[model samples]
Target: MRVLAFLDGTLADPDQAHLRVDDLSVLRGDGVFETILVTDGRPRELGPHLDRLARSAAMLDLPEPDRAAWERVVQLVIDNWSGGSEIALKLVYTRGVEGDPNATPTAFALGMEIDEKVKRARAEGIAAVTLERGIGTDLMERAPWLLLGAKSLSYAVNMAAVREAARRGASDVIFTATDGSVLEGPTSAVILVRGRTLYTPPPTIGILPGTTQGDVFRAAERAGWQTVVESFPASELTSADAVFLASSVRKVTRVHTLDGQPLADSTELHAELAKVYDSQYD
Candidate 1:
């Protein structure tokens, strides 16, 4: 469904907007972005999403969006959204229109409806394949200036990884490194249950520091479930009692299989966690 676009402050129709594809955000993926869920016309975890949006923009050396105005834009989009049970509100700030690296920055905020099938996947669990895709420690060894943790606009690689996983008959990819250390997912956060302890990779290891996962941890604590963030190899995942991917839109979804091996269902915990997450937005 189509929604209005808010660039800096001006509003325009996305279908007729004049956003340049070759802008710095497109050419170099030099931008920071956030995807917040809109539930019943209200944006979920807006404060944290804006917090990270600014943080990510700072990391990429891009100008931050005006936080107060950005929030209003999201609400406006929710109000204008067409067939929305819920929608994904996205705000993007880029080091502007294609030019020298020192050019001015451009930014935009809009809402996109969450795909219905993806929403359905939350009810029915998702299958995943492990992709040996880790953000290497040596940024200088690769592109030092690129925003590693920033939700930069360069999604080609991430899309490719998801496609690779889909090729293996899985819905998504759980990334790992050459050394077997498990990382986050192509788009979602990786969450695994190790019997009593719930484990996720720490942000120190080049993860996006998931805001939704952060809430889940707090909720788990309230639910009397143990939560921990530590680094471990993907090999450890095979032995995990259950696995799932978490995100604002999907909420919390079970991972039934990893590389063809079945993972025990964590339906009970998923339900418990869902209630906690759903309550936050409500």
Candidate 2:
């Protein structure tokens, strides 16, 4: 991974920086971030990415970085290219050091070569299990201070679940409420397909609204495909005309199995939807 750390208006290497854990971003996880897929050497759905980033920043009540400045940094990182069409560009902003010593959180963009495994999973559908419990809404509401829908540095819990899913022989996990309503995955947004229509858990479900989902759904409409936002139980998913997960990285992948049960076939839909999506973004 090649890094260009943006610290107080200067770009430096992470190893050379005096970054510490005391920063509020580190101490309290007070920050917002985004993972964007670089297409044609550019960030796909950049507008939506910025929109979500701003919304996340507002939710966290953290200092907001100028979009133009940040966008330049990303472009610089790409122009300084080390030669990988598939690059994972991540922007992390924090409130700086927590204590007096390392007080200000230094923001930097760390870029890495996209993993071949993730690419393969996009081409080949993944097997996943439905999580029995979705994240609590009360924490996000009552504690309005909580990260909630914001993509913050506090991702330990989410990463843990994804790791566990891999350990269990699945590519990812789809979160669901105790009542069986599906939500989202650890890193990707959830999108379920039925016939030519596409459905996903609404943002109101306490899931991070997905940019990729928005892109495809709009593309689906342009391509004459049906798209809807509504609630459905896990049992209904078992009977879905087609079930798949969508994200910028994974694109559109049909979910073939869940909890030892073979899921329905949505390969043709996946292909058609993939065309509409990939034509614009991938």
Candidate 3:
């Protein structure tokens, strides 16, 4: 439970909150966030995470973040925290207090110990269920304000999806478009492996671009694997040699079952991919 926070250039106790009541992020979920994995007090793929945060902020019409300030604050938190070998570093930026049109965006960085559950999932694998997101693939382009491509604080829906999966006796969820196109996981990017080809959904179809997935694909490419960005139906998942949900904090987690049906047990592929993942971070 060790936690530390840097709020608006000042270090603060995370237990003792400092956010205002009128902050739009609290009131309307108008904000963007990034969660990076910190190993031995160093954040992995930091630049890409910050780049995504800036892009998300832009989508929300919030002012650009002070990247240097965020980097310094994150490093400071990592240095001062007493967490274990790995930590989850989260950066958040809000639209600020309501009614104060010129109010500065409320930004903060929080660091905490990584969850044991996340580690276990990577080690043992998980089962998922496909759920319809009830939106068309091109809806984001037609309705830009829906904030589909942005990783905003409005995660209640995603949280609900995971809960629904749990109630159905599953550990996670893979959301599909109304037309049954596999989009992504609730909180991670979905990657399907077939033989030597790795497939992932493209961002243009309204999925959040994943920094961890990009790193993994690049590493896989160097290891003689082909990377392709494309969308396929949910049924395609069960046919793949292996399936995984990748994110900065969780790293890589294999999916062994979807809707209680067994998927291809590609332990060999998983081990090979794990080698690539470890080599980069280690």
Better of 2 and 3 by lDDT: 3
Best by lDDT: 3
Query: Tens digit of lDDT per residue, candidate 2, span 67-177?
Result: 887788777777765757766778888777665664444576766777887878777778988775545533446665655577777888778888878787787888877
lDDT per prediction?
0.78, 0.75, 0.89
Better of 1 and 3 by TM-score: 3
Tens-place lDDT digits, model 3, residues 90-144: 8989898999968988888888787888888888889899998988899888888
Q: Of the candidates numbered 1 and 3, which has the greater lDDT value?
A: 3
RMSD of 3: 1.2
Sort order, TM-score high to low = 3, 1, 2
- lDDT of candidate 1? 0.78
lDDT of 2: 0.75
Stronger candidate by lDDT (1 vs 2): 1
Winner of 1 and 2 under TM-score: 1
Clashing pairs in 3: none
For model 2, the stretches where C-alpha displacement exceeds 4 angstroms are 5-10, 14-18, 100-105, 134-143
Task: Return the TM-score for candidate 1, rounded to 2 decimals.
Answer: 0.91
Global lDDT for candidate 3? 0.89
> What is candidate 1's CA lDDT for residue 4?
63
Q: Residue 142 of model 3: what lDDT?
A: 86
What's the TM-score of each model vs. the native? 0.91, 0.90, 0.97
